[model samples]
Target: MENSTQITIENIQYSLSDIEKDCWSRLVNGAVKSRSPFHTPAVATFGQKEISLRTVVLRKTIPETREIRFHTDVRSRKWAELLSNPAISALFYDASTRIQLRLNGLASLHQHNDITNDAWQKTTLSSRRCYLTLHSPSSFSDIPTSGLTEDIEQENLSFEESEIGLKNFGIVSIHVQSIDWLWLHHAGHRRAFFDYTDGKYQWMIP
Candidate 1:
């Protein structure tokens, strides 16, 4: 029943480094595996007006730099909020693994640049549809809407046609400053806090 790290009186099986590796492993999998629980995380932002939270798909993760990336429409509210306030936090949880990760970081926006260009090149025509909206996200409409024109909504765009969406597509990168990891188990629970700024971590009572 036990693997690399097991529930113990002291719960010292996983070292700080091991925990960090596991954290990134899950994140990487989340980015590539659509079924993974971590594939979509709650991204939160604190702006001048209010605290905004939204669930976004995990597009990429770079462990070396502790950076995470997600795609967003340049006109989305979250994109505007991040531009105004770089502070951000992403929360992830895997029920099957009984693990939770909370990441605090600063966000940077990329548009019409190599970063966004690469991302756009990898996006499918269907996935690029959101960026072709007639109105910016959150814009009040006469009726509830997805923001796309009726014809565009009913058909898929060609690769050439999808090019127009690139103007509205952008990449949101989060430079992780710290990570709070938690493992839940019936026998006991384990918690750890990692401070990337100082490269230090410590176990916490769970």
Candidate 2:
């Protein structure tokens, strides 16, 4: 019989296969559109042993170039760790379809670039306000203060006063090297791995 042509939750069964190299190519190239409500990238950072997970907005993806981008605060612990060890992993889960993908890549910080600047500009005021805080990421305080302080300095303000807080904006770009996909079904489970370096995709025991 011919394979299912539709690419929805119901047709996902037919699309099951190795985490195709082309999938990685599309992800890296920002070709495959995101159907999940999470238009951003979800990343998992490894600590000494524990794991830190958070939603990271996808900044850019260049499949042919093998580059993926996300952003965060420079003062964050994740930023410090990525600097020491570029290797990182990001997980994308689509609960509606029971699909979870683990992506492995090397992450690099972009401190200066049009892309970073553009992303900073696009940031909403509520989000940009995050950069105005005096405390560093994970810093502790005796009392609770709003995430943003009202006393932003005039000299530090940007041309668009609204963007003044974005001075601390930091962008991270992850260059994917491999990907693994896991699918859970009522009858059985499927798992696959893809290696970009080798251009191969193979099924694996779940």
Candidate 3:
């Protein structure tokens, strides 16, 4: 029999194990259903000589494939950083469950391709406005603005108007290689580490 434990978070019960499968299942559930911003993970990428971290929304999760996706502007600094180095780390914490997940993975960027086109097609016009900016993300400006052009009315933009933003849209797919799961409790803490590349799963002292 597989060793398991029952835990409750936000009135939902989960039968978890000291393995990658259960942990990944819970993570997918959190990303898809959790209303908290904790679902937005902090992704760290290799910078010039150091590591840069930024919070990004979790757009999709594929447990079977061990992949997660997030959208971004192709002109963003992080996009450039990922292009230089695909290796990255993502951190997620759920306050309600007191669970922390650290994931290490390789990211693939999709731009001006079928992947980007599919993602853009599913995005709403309002959300697409961010990619229609007159300048690339993080550009220096004398004045602060919403990033969109002064003449472009936010709510009035038509589908064709939003289509122009497709050129700036990009999708990032992270293929997870390892995951570290930690749970905090007053009585005792539990932790587990999983390495998919080596097919190893073990409990760690917490």
Which 10 consecutive residues of model 2 have the lowest summed lDDT? Answer: 1-10
Q: Which pairs of residues have clashing backbones in candidate 3?
A: none
lDDT tens per residue, model 3, 1-206: 22355545445554434245656666676567647544689999996888889988888889889999889999998899999999989998877768888999999999999888888999988789888888898899888788776656446778887898998999999999999988898967878778889987777787
Best by lDDT: 1
TM-score of 3: 0.87
Model 1, 135-179: lDDT tens digits are 888889888788888767876557898789999999999999999
Runs off by more than 4 Å, candidate 2? 1-41, 47-51, 150-159
Ranking of predictions according to TM-score: 1, 3, 2
Model 1 compared with the native: what TM-score? Answer: 0.92
Error of 2 at 64 (Å): 2.8
What is the C-alpha lDDT profile of model 2 across 1-206, one tens digit per residue?
Answer: 22433122353333434236435543543323555433465787776667777887665667666777876888888888888778888777666757777889888887657877888877766567667777777888888765455544323444477664566788888888888877787866767777788987677777
For model 1, where is the 10-residue window of minimal lDDT?
1-10
Total clashing pairs for each candidate: 0, 4, 0
**Considering lDDT, where higher is better, how would the candidates rank from best to worst?**
1, 3, 2
Q: Estimated TM-score per prediction? A: 0.92, 0.76, 0.87
